[model samples]
Target: MPEPDPNVRLSNAEREALIARLQTATEEGRLDLHEFAERSREVYEARTYADVERLLTDLPAEDRALAVPRAPAASGDMVLEPSYTHLKRQGAWIVPGLIRVNPKYSRVTLDFRTAEFTTREVEIAVNLEYAGLKVILPKGAHAIDDGVILEGGQVINRAFTPGGGQRIRLTGRVLYSRLKVRYERRFLWWRW
Candidate 1:
């Protein structure tokens, strides 16, 4: 697979691989426990491939190689299935035209506040079970709750407009879960 664009989002496996390298560095006496703990938090909080790479910039090239980003799936569509861990997609990562989120008993967040969109109109098909999905759209972006069958589930749209910079159509089923679409709270005061 070719190297992914630096703006691509890092997967859970990729984050784990980077952390594994950090663990190795700690064992090799290259990093102290304090540094390891700090870096580990940054790794988990990282969103884009560039963020992951930045964490290993001070390390040796051999260790940095473990942070190499992988290209998107050949299918073009992005599929997110987080079982237990929290899945967050934020920062400068590129958003595909189509995204299918199928989470089981996990909390998933797709924050597009500073993300790059490949398409003007994006479709998010969320099929969630016993999990919650929150989508934070960028400013001027509009979201439309097209058709999402709910079985004891709730869909909250706090940032849905008819037309705007980008259009997001939500579709699929939610069983005993919650789907929330809202804009980021600006300055911790207003939701814009």
Candidate 2:
């Protein structure tokens, strides 16, 4: 296959796809955290194909599979209603750009270990009344919790890092409920 025009301007979706590939490379140990961070910043700032391509020149070609396009979900929002049931989102599901968790008298758990993110940044909005929400993220995932509003509830965050890997922004209100954010290493045997 002929190589794409390096000078061609990249679209938003194309930039996001490249970022996803970089994230996968980081997770696969093909690139270190520092390299991933540097490349990610370059990806976002890249205006042409060559700018983005230069960042991935050292990465293996297999990482291109991570950029394959997928069908969009019916709804990007995840809602939990008033019930005693527990809602969990894990595995190879696509991580939406915006996730809404509004549960009354229920528990919601969102695990982003193996989830595929189409964007470099993900925003999760939580609004719980008399419910509980626990978000589990991979170790390198960076979290921001400044937008959370707690009313008669407590939020325990163990995953708030300023400049980590993929960015996750948590925002919403919790009334008479509990919200916890924690992180776990992707591989138990490997430590970076």
Candidate 3:
């Protein structure tokens, strides 16, 4: 693989624009977070303007200009499969089986109690962060907001996940009771 370009990196504004476009793909369930991140990182480290332009020149053209770059069904393109697993309902609490998050996929899930006539399953996305995450802690407790602060200006704030990749080993914590941290990616669709 080509080494990332540090000298010709994207500006914050340009990076934000690219991310915004990627968000469109994510919202539409077109590009899973992990894939989005991989593509994003590649784009971010683009060395030449031509490379960046070509990279984004093929974004899906459809109703929403914000649509994520569809996997070019060119045979070599990878297919996206479902990433949800079963949710364990242990009395009042709920939990997922296992999840994985990477530069190609990230997801989020909400855990809650369910009433009769319903069973819920979900996978909370944590890695491959596009948007931030929001966390609500119980009463009389507190926690910090940074997940893993790296040295290369890369911050893996588990608190700001959009939720729904699969590989999950990271998360954010909100210190204190009744605390709601406004993260970027809040997976509201996750439930029990």
The TM-score leader among the candidates is 1
How many residue pairs collide in each prediction? 0, 0, 37
1 or 3, greater by lDDT: 1
lDDT of 1: 0.81
Which residue runs does candidate 1 get wrong by more than 4 Å? Answer: 1-75, 188-192
Tens-place lDDT digits, model 1, residues 45-135: 9998788777787889777634344443333788787676577877666778999999999999999988778888889999999999999
TM-scores of all candidate predictions against the true structure: 0.64, 0.57, 0.29
Q: Could you give me the TM-score of model 1 versus the true structure?
A: 0.64
lDDT of 3 by residue, 1-192 (tens): 343343554443444345556656766887876877677677567655455555454566442222323221122211112234211212222233332332222223322322111112223333432322323222222323345332322332333343332222333221221112322334688632
For candidate 2, lDDT tens digit of each residue in 112-167?
88777877888888888999988888768878889999899998988887555789
Ranking by lDDT: 1, 2, 3
The global Cα lDDT (0 to 1) of model 2 is 0.75
Q: Which candidate is the best by lDDT?
A: 1
Q: Between the candidate structures 2 and 3, which one is better when assessed by lDDT?
A: 2
lDDT (0-100) at residue 43 of candidate 2?
Answer: 73
The predictions' CA RMSDs to the true structure, in order, are 7.8, 13.8, 17.4
